[model samples]
Target: MSKKPAGETLYVILGLLFIAVIGLRTISTPELWTHLAQGQHNAPISFLASDSAVNTTWLYDKLAYLMWSIGKAPLLILLNIVGLVGAFVLLLRVSEKWGGALSQGFALLIAGHLMFQMIDVGPEVCMMLFIALFLYLLTTQKSPAVLFGALIPLQILWTNLHGSFLFGPILAGLVAAQAAQQAKPSGGRKKNQTNLSGTLGLLAIALLVATLINPSFIKLHGQVIAGIQSPAPVYHSSLFIEYFQIPALKPLILFTMILGAGGLITLKKRLPLTLTAIAVFGAFLVWTSPYHAMLFAILSLPFIVLSLTAISEYIHSSLEQMLGGKAKLVPGIMGGVLVLLFIASIIPAATGCAY
Candidate 1:
């Protein structure tokens, strides 16, 4: 492991309490309370299949119950904060792996908007840590066996932990596809891509199998699909306003688009096909299901961070050239602009996710 930089640590500590900043603007509803109450003496799997009146899977219900057993109900909230903070910490680490300092803008954006929300004690925050870790591995881990092995436990655990476990294999397939494309031979391209393609294929299939190990087995897939396809009222009237329908050109979404454009224009290095494909898919998910914008954003964060960092460097270099090599001024100017953007991003965050 490498030493973590001080700048990146801002979110790690503050993020633990980020959700608390908004005070009473919480997403916790009646259902979460019921689930935790039942989980006190019931098995975790019992809660998975028996939606009963809750009509929702309880991901961390048992955790909450066990915490309460030890006189630690408050500890449940702390874990949520820990996972949220860890997600950013892992993200910063991954972005730094690609190239140090590329994560600055994205990290700041997260701290400004994502950190302070009412996402209290849900499995989704825990889910973020896993997704972030997977992405971190995606960026730095090259060994096929290692990735495959890692996903087996992760998918199994995720499937039981949350309904969004499918994201694990889906992301894995996209990355593997990217790897295969990159590994293509100079000649007879199709033939050369086989080694990685085969490995990735096995990994994907294995991950799918891993999902089956969950309590719901194959039925879990159908349940998740049905949940997605069903026209739920949660999209519009849920307690969590973030789940509400997104307007055309919402401020955050619009800013994300502009940031992406600037990144493409300024990025000095070539964009990987894998990242390009993931970004497209991420955009589609966020557009279609605004409920999971936070999840999609976190998953695609590495690519976003990389792009922004490239833009920053490009501007600095351009300014240096324009100023006849007085590069020192460039840092001060960009740094000030970064501070301004950070301040500007908080404006919408105060209102929380505009569901």
Candidate 2:
């Protein structure tokens, strides 16, 4: 077996730091306490019986109740920590598969930003984990049925956890559409595309059904849609954070968007359709919700790393031709310096600097 390199070790360390930042926020925030109190206060049988109409995502509520009953603070903290770690691990695996040390480091940094967004308590964290899993399955598995079947439960859980359940189908459908369009001209390609699309459609429908499995039934869906359509209070508030904007023009946001665009432009021919699909879907999500900006970062990181690698290789080859191999160290040093600058710019100097 090959040994892990020093750069990979640095990536792991950065990933851990990311988790630590998120964990600190998770443990310190008063929001979890309110959520816990709400869950525990409504744990009575009579409460459920009387107020079923108001209870959306009763399954998630039940889980929160369980956590509160066990050891409120510890349980909630553990859940967030585990979920954050799981997200990082999945991202690392995906990036390692797609690129290498550079991809892994980029994935770690992007996932860190995601954790920093404080998605630990809500269904968004679970959705992110499932999304990571879905990406893994789609990339590694050859059989579309197997991947689709596996995703059904994730979809169900997503529906129960957050209104973002729709994102799963939207994401999966986009990828399926891309796959279908990119299918080969052979008869087998058509069959595969049809099956893939059908499976994704079925899973989406099953998820919708699962949403109805709760007591609120259709009301839950109505509430979710209403929530999405409703304007966020933050949009009107004095806080002008870039993530809350409909179309963020922040420097970091523009940089990531440019990086994603550059990746597509540079490696459109070399990348797999599935990878492109993930990038495009993530980009769309970022366009739709500033909350998904970190997701865009995560999805684009591997592509950018791969693109940079390709560019580095190209530059090295070109320089070799120009200088007869005497200038190899120049490209290597330049790449290393650029990577360092990238890392420095992204990393917060202090906790107060995070904002």
Candidate 3:
């Protein structure tokens, strides 16, 4: 690996530290308890195992079984903790591709918000990781054809791990759509950008096909949609606060509120198409139910942060222009409030103060 760059290295270390603190701060047994005990009488392949086994996500079950067997703890805290670090790294890198340099203020806001989300380690934890990772892979791909191929393995694995795998291709298709728009058709020889964008639609199709390779097959796709579209809540009432139902308030909702404000204010300007779509998808999930708010928060971060940063600059510059240097003292006073909120919100996690 290449030597670590200076500025990014520290933030990465801090990110890992934040995850570690959160992971260790709260320890809960995930639902691997019964699965491990029940599977002892059967083979590992879940297909011939149990007709009543709702946990067809055998890939994760096996991993969970391994960890639970050895450690006897229904916890993948370390794994999920590391996965959180990787997810953010992948997210920011991909988001940076569209948003330019992320401001430190926005970075803190994102990190602090996620500390709460990371405290619970379960199937959704890895789901979040692969969601970010899938987008990152698609974004980083140099060739369009290879991009589709790369998603196959991930999509297959993701399908076996969590029901949220359905969104992988949807998100990828959205990104591909944006790429197609960016790559306006032209006969010019130097139209690499256009060529790359054109292939994303194809990639989306391939990803769709790859998702079928999972053991659950086509039923998984239909089943997930049915669950999501079910009139009654798919997640039970006694689960986490996020899974309660519609009209629930989660911490991530606060970020989306900011994101909505920033997105609307900046609508007249030339923002990214893909970013806007991602934000829209996030908002839809939030509106549909609170359970998907985590996905929205992850998707909307760069957009919200970048927009707020721009807004801050606009406000400061406008004030300076209007007041003719008389407004120079405003930031010093206001900056303190922002800083205090930052520390209150984010610093404790970094320092391992759990509460």
Model 3 Cα lDDT, one tens digit per residue, 308-329: 6566666768898899878787
lDDT: which candidate is best? Answer: 3
Tens digits of per-residue lDDT for model 2 on 1-355? Answer: 4877775566566655555555544445454554555566755323456643344445565687787688866776678667756765665666665566654555455545533543446545566666667666655565656765777777777777765567566656656666666667787778877777676666656655655655566877777777658723322334555555433334555565666665666553556655666677777766666666556655655565665555555566778889986875774465365467445634652344555
Best by TM-score: 1
lDDT (Cα, 0-100) at 329 in candidate 2:
74
Model 3, TM vs. native: 0.76
How many angstroms is residue 268 displaced in model 3 relative to the true structure, after the best TM-score fit? 7.0
Q: Which tens-of-lDDT digit does each residue in 151-211 have in candidate 1?
A: 7888787787777777777767877777676764566766656666677777878888888
lDDT values of the candidates?
Answer: 0.62, 0.59, 0.63
Using all chains and alpha carbons, the TM-scores for the candidates as numbered come to 0.77, 0.74, 0.76
Clash counts for all predictions: 1, 0, 0
